[model samples]
Target: MAARNSAPEKRPGLISQIKTLLKFTKDVYPWLPWVLIGIIVAGIALGVGLGFLIPPVALWSIILWGVTGLMLGFLAAMITMSRLATKAMYAKIDGMPGATGYVITSGLGRGWHADETPVGVNPKTQDAVYRAIGRAGILIVGEGAEGRLSRLINEEKMRAKRVAPQVPVHVMYVGNGEGQVSIKALGKTVKALPKSISKATQAAVIKRMDSMTQGMASLPIPKGIDPTKVRAPRPR
Candidate 1:
């Protein structure tokens, strides 16, 4: 009980976390000097105009200016980081296998889980597999080489059956290779799972897997490899 309470206590304050993230991005690439410049200019201009119109609103006009400046700065920071994050994701996974799966799991919200499955072929067949077990059923996706991913996906289905035998399982091969689903179509693929599995079954499956997976230590990440860089690729 104490440990569970401590977990919640340890979560960072929301505003502080957002500020910390903004600072970290500024530390990383320093990619948006111009955006910051524009923000300062715009904030100053807006604050000056507003000050002239609403004389009594701000006790000290300078304080209002500073507040306005911070708001504009934050907005600018958001735009810069959003674009950089997208480009960084592409750069990180360009030559790696299972890249699409990374994008889906990271970009999508809850009810979806993903992991790398390097079943065969480092140069081609490595796959990023994803699963969503919901009111519908279990939807599995393998994104990588088309030819080998099918077999790998089938094996995963068999494994899931052993884990939760009653859950209906559906699979898709996410790739442009023959008889495969393309990367961009991943969300649509998942949205199509049959509404066969019940809410109770989904909850049971998650509980069972959570218990089974507990107490295992996470693998150490490779040197100089950012977590973002390993997005869709399975470890080789």
Candidate 2:
């Protein structure tokens, strides 16, 4: 049986991350030149804004503008990159057996505990519920066709409530159909939930859930797709 460790993978250095991020920008937006131009213009504008606050001396002005422009440019790149990556990645994994779980788990950032594998999966419908513990209490991300997850959601909720009945168990559905959240906004949407627990409580929840699900089998990723490399640039 495969191990079920859920630690966040180590990220490469900032330089390497920037390269990967920029490469993604290029791949997803073929109009690379336009993006560069836009960022450059934005950068220059930011630099000009800062120049007003600083002295008019040539040396200081030059340095300040250079730094400001660079930072703004990188900021623009990261924002655009994340949006494009979200669209591309979600489009690729949408409607897959465990895509909702995959997207939710991968995109969650710090201050939360998330597992890439589903904590509860329905054999008949291929529905899966991915779990995360954070300031918002326990969240169950239900991924399947819209309106088809009542049974799975109820079962998973019961399982979660059985262990920690006091903790809130919120369910989020992922799909293009009505009443479902879009994949592109999955991470942001989850993070926006009201905080219901403290850091200590969140950790306790994770520890308890860990013990309960440690031996559970992993949910399957669809064939021929690599979730880790899904954000990588594709061949032209």
Candidate 3:
């Protein structure tokens, strides 16, 4: 018998990834290309201008500076694209139930331990509360009307407080309503909370909370957007 042949799976190349990202971003933001071009140009001009300030500028130095500027311009463009891509993603998922959980699960940077599945959810209204533990202590993020989520948020808050009496518990609501955080800003808001607990304390709180909430019945979250497909590329 002939030996079986197999082909290895291929991941998208960097260039391909950039192209896909550009297309995705462009769909949501029509002026993305122009904005990126302008940002890149500005970055290049700034980098080359700084290079000219160096002592004893020569032809070689000018060429090197030009190259450096070009690289910096690309880097700036990438960063800008990443941010815009994130905004576009949030816009796509905004107002959908469980968006808060999706964002928390995607990431809130390092040192964050978030429960992607909401700890408290209202099946009737699709309101929910998500929890996260970090140096900032406990974050309780709620999606749904503030009035409707008040009791749910309070219950989750009380439960967290019971598990970790000393740990700080912060609450935030995600929506377009007054005083609610936008989906795009949810991660930033969570990360910006004042650090009130040490790493050890954070770990302890997470442990206690996990053990306490373990085996609790999960509520049915409204299905719509897939969190996996809603992720934005991170900036290098």
Computed on alpha carbons, the lDDT of every model, listed in order, comes to 0.57, 0.73, 0.83
TM-score of 3: 0.79
Best by lDDT: 3
What's the TM-score of each model vs. the native?
Answer: 0.56, 0.68, 0.79
Q: Candidate 3: how many backbone clashes?
A: 0
Comparison by TM-score, 2 against 3, better one:
3
- Quality of model 2 by C-alpha lDDT: 0.73
lDDT of 1 by residue, 69-151 (tens): 66876676666665654454455454345555455556545665444322222233334455555666666766555555666
Better lDDT candidate (1, 3): 3
Off by over 4 Å in 3: 1-9, 37-72, 234-236
lDDT of 3 by residue, 77-101 (tens): 8988988897788888999877888
Supply the global lDDT for candidate 1: 0.57
Clashing pairs in 1: 98-232
- TM-score ranking from best to worst? 3, 2, 1
Error of 1 at 157 (Å): 4.2
Residue-pair clash count for candidate 2: 0
